[model samples]
Target: MEYFIQQLINGLTLGGIYALIALGYTMVYGIIQLINFAHGEFFAAGGYMGVILLSFLSANGYLATYPWLCLSGAIILSMAYCSLLATGVEKIAYKPLRKSSRLSVLLSALGMSIFIQNGLMLTQGVYDKAYPTIFSQGGFDFGNIKVSYMQIVMLLITILLLILLNLLVFKTRIGKAMRATAQDKTMSSLVGIKSDRIISLTFIIGASLAAAAGIMVGMYYGSVGYTMGFVPGIKAFAAAVLGGIGNITGAMIGGFLIGMIEIFGAGYISSEYKDVFAFIILIGVLYFMPTGIMGENIDDTRV
Candidate 1:
């Protein structure tokens, strides 16, 4: 039972990270049917940015003097970096292909993904970059289960960000505009909502969440690499699909479900087959309930 509880904790932590990345996928697809396959690169870039910033800080002897401050600043800068990178990618790579066929847009997204991955490889190298330890080490005991402080902090940050995001999407004028554009781009433009700007903001918001997840993953795993995002990216996309693509709440629930599946499958079954569980669920969901558990809104135009 203690071991089961331990796996549950681990699953939730992994789920939080997946949920954050899955939001980017759902939000972008909601507004524009483009999958933006390169979205995962934003996660990799943020991880690299965090490592780069921490390296510079360590070299300057500031990491030890102001660990929390430095960590906070690195996260902020990494998120900004990813957010700007996403906006630029949208304008440069996606916007031109907007009027083109879906095949063209999808191919462009795949091309961009390749381009970004290789760029990160050339710049950050293929070697794993270690995240500098700025956090004070400690753990809490729950009976026979022990959870690290990093786990607690990561969960807290995820919850806080989720709350803020919910407020932004549900309460703000921009949020309403986003919903309007997603619902009907033509009518939104008719009503004076700039679909282009809303689309850009959607990418920005998604990229920011991806960045936050990147930071958490880096801090938790103690390492980041150029290819780090690929697996998680695929799983997150599955989560988006599992939760009904284009639905924010669906993505969140899907992420947690996938995470739990992976964790429990590994713990109880075979570690080698852990990844198989998520893909199996994804296949099952696609085959059985194509609309996902949340049921997709089919009225959105693909174009």
Candidate 2:
């Protein structure tokens, strides 16, 4: 029971990370139909940006005593950087192909992904950098089950963000516009909605969320690498698909499910192949329910 509880906590935390990143994929797909393959790189960019900001603060004596303030600053900076990066990608890489063929946009997305990856490698190097520990060392224990403060924090962050996203998508005017645009770009434009603006906003929101996830992962793991986004990115993409692409709620559920599967499969099956577990589940899901858990909603077809 203790082992089970411990693993559950770990899985939830991991799922939270995947869900946040997966939201980016789903949102982009929901609004523009473009996969935004470079999104994973955006996640990496956020982590690297946080690391740089934290290092600067530490070196400047800004974080010498006010650790919380430094941490807050890093988070804010990381989010901001991610928002700009996302908006820039849309304006530069994707906007040009908005009227082009789907294949053209997809190819551009792939190229953008490679470009960002190599750009980071050249700038930050290929080695892993140690991440600064922001949270105090400790964990709540119960009957041999231990839950780290970082895990709790990650879960809370994920929930808070999820709530915020839900409200934004369901309760706001912009959210309605996004949905409308998703349903039919031509109709949205005819109804006085600027599809381009909605699409850009979608990218911004998605990128910012992914950035938060990246920063949280770096802090939890104590280190980060340029390529860290590759596996996680793929997994998050799978989670989006598993939950049903373009479905926000489905993305959240799928992320948690994937997390549980990966962690439990590692514990019960083989740790060596734990990572492959997500893909296996993905294949099974696709084979049986290609529309995914929520079923693809034609109301909001991918752009």
Candidate 3:
């Protein structure tokens, strides 16, 4: 039971990160029906940005005196940076192909992914940059279970972000506009909603979430790499699909499920087969529920 609890906590932590990343996938697909293969690059960019900003703080002696403040500033700045980056990617790569075939848009997204990945490698180098040790060292003990401060922090941020997102989607006027635009772009435009703006906003929001996930992952793992986003990105995409691709709630649930499966599979079976275990579960679930665990009655257009 102690071992099970340990793995469960680990799973939730990993799941939260994946949920953050997966939300990006679901939101974008909900709005535009695009898979957005380049979305992962935003995560990578956020990790790099977080490391860069935090390192600057450390160098300037700011982090030592005000660790939490510095960390918060880094996260906000990274999210903003990624939001701007997503906007640029949307305007440059996706906007022009809005009326084009799905294949063209998909190819463009793939090209953008390659382009961004290579750009990161060129600019940040292929080496893994170590995150400054701050919260990485501390943890709390509950009986035989051990939990890190990083895990607590990560979970709080994840839950907070998720709540804020739910409120944004279900409560705000902008969110209403987004939902309307998703449901019927032409009709929404005719009804005075700007579909283009909503689409851009969707991209911005998704990128911001991915950015947060990137920072959390870096803090948890103690390092960041230029190539770090690819696998997690793919897994998050699987989570999105598993949860019903375009459904927000589904994405979150799918992410947690995938994370739990990976952790348990690693704990009981072998670490070497962790990734395979995640995919296998995804396949099994899809085989039984083609529309995903939460895909039922979810309009693809509603966020």
Q: Which has the greatest TM-score? A: 3
Model 3, residue 134: C-alpha shift (Å): 1.2
TM-score for each of the candidates: 0.96, 0.95, 0.98
Tens-digit lDDT track of model 3 for 1-303: 999999999999999999999999989988888999999999999999999999999999999999999999999999999999999999999999999998898899999999999999999998999999986988999999999999999999999999999999989999899888878889999999989999999999999999999998998999999888899999999999999888899999999988999999999999999989999988888899887888865454566
lDDT tens string, model 2, 1-303?
A: 778888898899999999999999998998877787998988999889878887788788777789778877788789999999989988999998889998999899899888988898999998987776656368898879888888888899899999999999999998899899988899999999998899899999999998999888888888778998888898999899999898899889989989999999998899899878878888898898887887575454742
lDDT of 1 at 189: 98
Q: What residue runs in model 3 are displaced by over 4 Å at the alpha carbon? A: 297-300
- Identify the runs in model 1 with alpha carbons over 4 angstroms from their true place: 300-303
Better of 1 and 2 by lDDT: 1
Worst 10 residues of 2 by lDDT: 294-303
Candidate 1 structure lDDT = 0.89
Where is model 2 more than 4 Å wrong at Cα?
298-303
The digit string of per-residue lDDT tens for model 1 on 136-193 reads 2678998999899999988898889888988888899998899989888899999999
Count steric clashes of candidate 1.
Answer: 0
The models' CA-based lDDT, in order, is 0.89, 0.87, 0.92
Error of 1 at 222 (Å): 0.6
Task: Quote model 1's TM-score.
Answer: 0.96
